[model samples]
Target: MATAIGMVELTSIARGIETCDYMVKAAQVDLLRSSTVCPGKYMIIVGGETGDVRAAMAEGIKRGGELVVDTLMLPNVHEQLIPAISMTNQVDVRGAVGVLEFYSIASAIIAADVAAKAANITLIEVRTGYAIGGKGFVTLTGDVGAVRAAVEAARKDAELLVETTVIPRPDKKLFDALL
Candidate 1:
């Protein structure tokens, strides 16, 4: 079965929590993370089989009402995405580096997945709306060509892309902070 990931971002923390509760009860999805983010937004991330994830997201969106800020359902998420989002992946930064910034946590996550799958790159980190005042960023490293390709792919159709940059030879100290 193809694993999937679903996310719901809401303006109200209480409503987001309630929606998450209802969503979990409506499907066989596992709640990955549910908490308030910077600037007082709420986000819920869930994972499971594609059908289950879709069902859960449908319930969340229905209950979210006007509180919904964004919703995402990736039926075949990149294998590196979940680990990177959870900050559990250890990446050896090499070659060029790419960075993508977004206004929302959900958008950054989606862009990271797209970039990781677009080229041969290592996801350095996926920082969501924690201390960045509801903004998020993703970092990746690979050869210059690969990194550029990945960044380009991430930029396509991404309305939330605040900034995108590719550093051919990033400072070693930079990796110390990011990875």
Candidate 2:
């Protein structure tokens, strides 16, 4: 299992692909994502051992250079984070719900990890890329206090225009739409 995750956002799609190649070749890291984002941006995500992830990120950054726009490296990631990012996490849809939105995918991912580690919450979803126009958001569910705390912690860790809301007990339709 990968114990660490790293992502690098780039302005040039061609350069992003090149960086992705260099990153994976530099270390034994899994390429989790390498695709274009909204507004003509590109992103690369990698996961592996902490040291391997660091080495891959270093190579990506070196190759990306000025094309690199944003980056994040979580050496000790929460267990639920990867599944949530992969859009495979099971959402029980119980308890209060919290939503955290950010201007960039990197920020959204970072916040999601922090939120999961902060409280006893289940990550419902982490939406990013084209459907959202490059902006990203995370949804989680837990008890009222846990949801609130998770939202706040995530909001603080994110950058750019961050917005957060906690629904005491969301309507079924609301959650249905969320899913």
Candidate 3:
């Protein structure tokens, strides 16, 4: 089966949870994540076959109504994306490091994908709307040139880029703290 990922971000936690329940019951999608984010927003992420994920997303959007903040359906997501977002991917932070912060989780995910495909960089982490007041951020590491290219690519079309920085040669302690 061709795997796909879908996400629904809602303004209200109660409505988001209710939509998530309807979404899952509407299709054979697997619920990957369902939780409240900072500032009292909620999100639901699901994964399954392409069609199933689409069906689930459709149900979520229909049920979300006025509470719908944002929605996404990636038919062909990067294989490493989930692990990176889940903070389970181990990446060696060598040479240089880049960070991209965004105002929305969907924008951050898009930036991460663009950055990963634009340069030979390893994703250190992809955090979304958990403890950062509903914002999102992604970290990457590679050679100086590669890191710069990745960060530049991510910044080009970000929804709201809070900040972006590329450290040419970060100290080990910084990597330890971040990674």
Put down candidate 2 lDDT per residue, 1-179, tens digits, no spaces.
44999999899999998999999999998887888998898989898899999999999999999999989898889988888887788887588999998888878888999999999999988787756789988999999999999998887746874688999989999987776
lDDT of each: 0.88, 0.88, 0.88
Could you tell me which residue pairs clash in candidate 3? Answer: none
Question: Could you give me the TM-score of model 3 versus the true structure?
Answer: 0.90
Candidate 3 local lDDT, residue 145: 96
Candidate 3 clash figure, as a count:
0
lDDT of 2: 0.88
Per residue, candidate 3 scores C-alpha lDDT tens digits across 38-147 of 98999998888999999999999999998998998877766667767767777854679899998888888888888988888888888889999999999889999999
Give per-residue CA lDDT, model 1, range 67-124, as digits (tens).
9988888888888888777777777657788999998777898899999889999888
lDDT of 1: 0.88
Candidate 3, residue 127: Cα displacement in angstroms equals 1.0
